[model samples]
Target: MNGKLLEGKVALVTGSGRGVGRGIALDLAAAGARVVVNDIGASTTGEGADLGPAQQVVEEIRAAGGHAVADTHSVADWDEAHAMVQTAIDAFGRIDIVINNAGILRDTIFHKMTREEFEAVINVNLNGPFYVSRAAAPHFKAQNGGNYVHITSSSGLIGNFGQANYAAAKLGVAALSKSIAMDMQRFNVRSNAVAPWAWTRMVNTIPAETEEQKKRVEGLMKLIPERIAPFVTALSSDAAAGVTGQIFGVRNNEIYLFSQSRPIRTAHTSDGWTPESVIERVFPMFENDFYPLHRSGDVFTWDPV
Candidate 1:
């Protein structure tokens, strides 16, 4: 699992200063990758910056006899993202894998959410991946081979209470992953989205206002970030040759394949139906198939496996 998987591969893992990203960076390096540990070193809410975290991870990798460098560029900025990509190329000569793992949480009730809150989450979570991936697109095309792993979330894939921004951004990441997979498959470039359910700083920021929320948080605490890395490492390798355009999940030892949005149920009428007809026929027919307003916790009611 160490040198056999990713020997000589160069990887860039954003937000690698702590939590899930940190776990991933360490795993990639342990698997024989020359990694670019990129982190803005900001708070969980995506404020401030420090070079210490990234540098420390780099030091850790180096001390372990793996290769790595530190990058402090903001993945949300187009120019900075390009620079981050450049760091990989400069450090290891070429980048073979990109982990778009940088993100921030700004959870607020939809109605009460401000534009700033929504945009901030979108900037780091959604736009950051796009920026970083786009920056690496040319190199991937040039090499005619590459792997992209976008860190998506269940908040968007399923539903959540006060994370419209995070959810929207994460779901958009799923679409982006799919589109990239389709668009770049001809070039032998692979793109996939992963929704990692780990108890990281991100999960720690969730508001446990209600008793149910508190219990959910308690369940989450058992899911360590390290559990999420092995699957990601597998996906980042050539062993995942034909795996692209898919949404996967990792919670503790459990791996999941999520269902994308599709027409689960349909009703047909030979003639054009009136509003009344749709209500009477379609409403009754679709009632049983309707999805409940379930949060991420509601769906994953079982303890982490």
Candidate 2:
């Protein structure tokens, strides 16, 4: 890849103080885009705030001779999200890309989950992207071209235990990306979601109940966030104009294009049947089409390539 693929673009990345977001911000900068590194410096559970994280990333970019500015804004807030986008414009003169990577986790079984836990996860993991994307919508429309990259997860794409809140928010984010892609297609705006499997602080929280589980987690730790950033940077570039409203996954040396929901089977009757008749006939015909319940780990059992 050319080192200057994004040469004149200005990109904004939320929650870029560290981890996956930081990797993305740095990669975009290295690709020649001016970057707005926005991060509230919140913990894994979204409590407290510091400016150090964002500033540190910004300094790293500068040390590498890449343009970057730090913006300590909470993406969960509507006003702050807008300010984050505006910060890009004020600093670099335009916003050409927005990566909504801010998120928090509050995992627990549904029976034991609190309303506070659920809402907190929703506010940051899901609503944060909505607010940031909404703020960037008008600018993208005016510019007639832009890109949005939302960070999602396999937990939401499939399912996971003790993560009702996180899964719901991540899935909601994927849906939101699809809606935005459709809404802005006419103006050349493209939006997509990435389900990244990297061993970040969030992933470290998952319990390894057995020796096998512990070994699996250890293996995943080698799939660093940097491995995911190149794909994200490509998606943000003009070269990926043909791709939109899609879900993708990145592991160690693997990339996956996920299948979207579609009708697997259909049933009909010459005349509309009663509920009893429908249950007797239609249910039997489509019984085999029903999907078995499976969690995220169950589906992705192989080691990351």
> Top model by TM-score, which number?
1
lDDT of model 2, residue 279: 88
Give Cα distance to truth, residue 145, candidate 1, Å: 0.1
Q: How far does residue 129 in candidate 1 sit from its true spot (Å)?
A: 0.6
Residue 99 error, candidate 1, Å: 0.5
Segments of candidate 1 deviating more than 4 angstroms: none
Q: Let me know the TM-score candidate 2 reaches against the reference structure.
A: 0.96
Full-model lDDT for every candidate: 0.93, 0.92
User: Candidates' TM-scores?
Assistant: 0.98, 0.96
Worst 10 residues of 1 by lDDT: 1-10
Per residue, candidate 1 scores C-alpha lDDT tens digits across 133-154 of 9999999999999999999999
Clashing pairs in 2: none
Backbone clash numbers for all candidates listed: 0, 0
